[model samples]
Target: MTFSLLARCPETGRFGMVISSSSPAVAARCAHARAGVGVAASQNITDPALGPALLDALARGRSAPEAMAEVTAIAPHIQYRQLLCVDAAGRTAHWSGERILGTWGVAEGDGAVAGGNLLAHDGVPAAMVAGFAAARGDLGDRLVAALRAGRDAGGEAGPVHSAGLLMVDAASWPVASLRCDWLDQGCPIEAVARAWDVYAPQMAAYVQRAMDPREAPSYGVPGDE
Candidate 1:
């Protein structure tokens, strides 16, 4: 019921992930990333702790594969979860338990990995990876592109009601975290893309304000003037 991508931007050393699901608020439990560590997605049965555990391992100098191995071994009821990760060095790894949902798939690209369960088709994950590779602009942009491609290729077996985009740069917190927790009618992936379009231009300004308000740009609203 979920599809997700985890990636490391070689150009900027950033980490990001895009996820969508028939389940509401999927990202709230599945998407995780640390500024200088890595990005991870824990789907399928959805064990939220696995994402943070994976990143903590990456921060401790484990490669993507090593982190995945350690987590999957220690994680309880591991035979039902799907996980993906990309470390700071751009190394990627993925795990699909034997009991994964219907028509699951996994794919890898230059610096990204994608996985899906209960998908319309197994090709969705590869299409997402290809879309990420072909996209231009920031890591967030590429991730949105991947999500769109997954939908285009046949996303979940049923319509997705929730979606999220998460990214982390040099800051301690996420530079971009957008979500459509539940959409009763429209497409959540498109909704997230629209949100990113509105947020991307102001992302740097927000960071500047957080780091040093004196040098940051004005709010530009009526009250600020």
Candidate 2:
């Protein structure tokens, strides 16, 4: 029911995830990341706690595989869960349990991993990783490219209704958290991309405004008098 990517940007040391699904608000449950740590995605009968648990393990100096092991060991209903994790060192690991939905699989690339369940085909995850690897520009752009690739390469077996992009830089707060909760006339992935296009240029300005309003650029809108 879902396809997702978790990634770390070597240039900026940021971690992020992009996700889409036939289910509404998939990313809120499936995509997870922590600054200076790593990323973990839990889907296919997702246990939302597993994402944070994996991050906690990574923060405690565990490798990706080790974290997955520890998390799955104690997590309830393990046989129904699918999890993928990438540590700060770029090590990756994943598990697709015995009872996950149709055509589920996973793939990895440099500093990234992709996974999917109830896919149109098993190739979706690999296509996402390849897309992330081949795309240019910042991490967000690459992630969105990967998402588009998954969509183009036959996404979910059913219509995809929701999508999200999440990223965190050095700061405690997220740098990007865009979601398309519902789509009536357009693709959710494309909607998220459009939101990013509007948000990207202003991100720095918004940050600057919070840090030092005097040094921040103008809002570029009217009525500042």
What's model 1's lDDT at 167? 97
Query: Which lDDT values do the candidates have, in the order given?
Result: 0.95, 0.91
Clashes of each: 0, 1
Q: Judge candidate 1 at residue 14 and give its lDDT.
A: 94
TM-score, cand. 2:
0.96
Model 1 lDDT tens row, 4-102: 988999989999999999999998999999998999999998999999999999999999999999999999989999999999889999999999999
Pick out the ten consecutive residues of candidate 2 with the lowest summed lDDT: 216-225
Instruction: Give the local distance difference test score of model 1.
Output: 0.95
What stretches of model 1 exceed 4 Å from their correct place? none
RMSD to the hidden true structure, all candidates: 0.7, 1.2
